[model samples]
Target: MAYWLFKTEPDTFSIDTLRLQKVACWEGVRNYQARNMLRDEIKLGDEVLIYHSSCKKIGVAGIARVVKEAYPDHFQFDPDSPYFDIKADPSNPRWMMVDIEFVRKFERIVTLAELKAIPDLENMPLVKRGNRLSVMPVSEDEWQTILHQE
Candidate 1:
């Protein structure tokens, strides 16, 4: 299975929230590049690293598994929803989402600084300069290297 890293603001939806809820609908992705990955690449059973971004303790907080594959992001169709897209049509969805189930929470965060310090992870998108896609693919080698830090 492929590996992925999904970034989220802790204040918005943290690893703790995922741990408590057990499963979460990973939605509201507005970027077309990220949306394409969600719709075309990510699949059920793929592992994920829940990375905390836009927060004080920014890092990879835990692991999750894609329990459900891509489906139309319903929020894009709800006028009252913040994620609503004026141009999105129900007949042809523009955004997609996946369902991820909490797998394990790391004992301690694998900090961004720590990740950047590792030579093996230098090629990882998350560690690259200015690479800010909410969803990013992680190579199997990168995945294992990061996990080893836990």
Candidate 2:
């Protein structure tokens, strides 16, 4: 039961989209570090904090649960897909994705400003400068602290 933060651009794939769809494949991760986390660390039944990034009201928007474990990201194999990788081989995948089911949408966002102001969350990667891995781990204490803001 690990905790994680998954960043998404609200316009690209918002919490609202997840809420509507119920379950969605978390794809388009290009970073090796983030890809590795999705492929190796994140697992079924894990909880996730849906963080809205690169948006006007950037913040933690909601919660989701990993309903399916990591598997090869099919988009990487499709030439028509923006995430397609020419170097990716079908026999050996270069990327992975997981299915996350919508859990809860917070009544209001827990703004980045508010998170940065929390002394206990100072160590969180999301609040740190230049630390932009889209998929990152969250400590139990940090998870509770962020949810407390909701």
Per-candidate TM equals: 0.98, 0.99
The sequence of per-residue lDDT tens digits that candidate 1 reaches over residues 44-119 is 9999999999888899999999999999999999999999999999999999999999999999999999999999
Q: What TM-score should be assigned to candidate 2?
A: 0.99
Q: What is the C-alpha lDDT of each candidate?
A: 0.96, 0.97
Candidate 2 lDDT by residue in tens digits, 61-142: 9999999999999999999999999999999999999999999999999999999999999999999999968999999999
Off by over 4 Å in 2: none
RMSD of 2: 0.6
Worst window of 10 by summed lDDT in candidate 1: 123-132
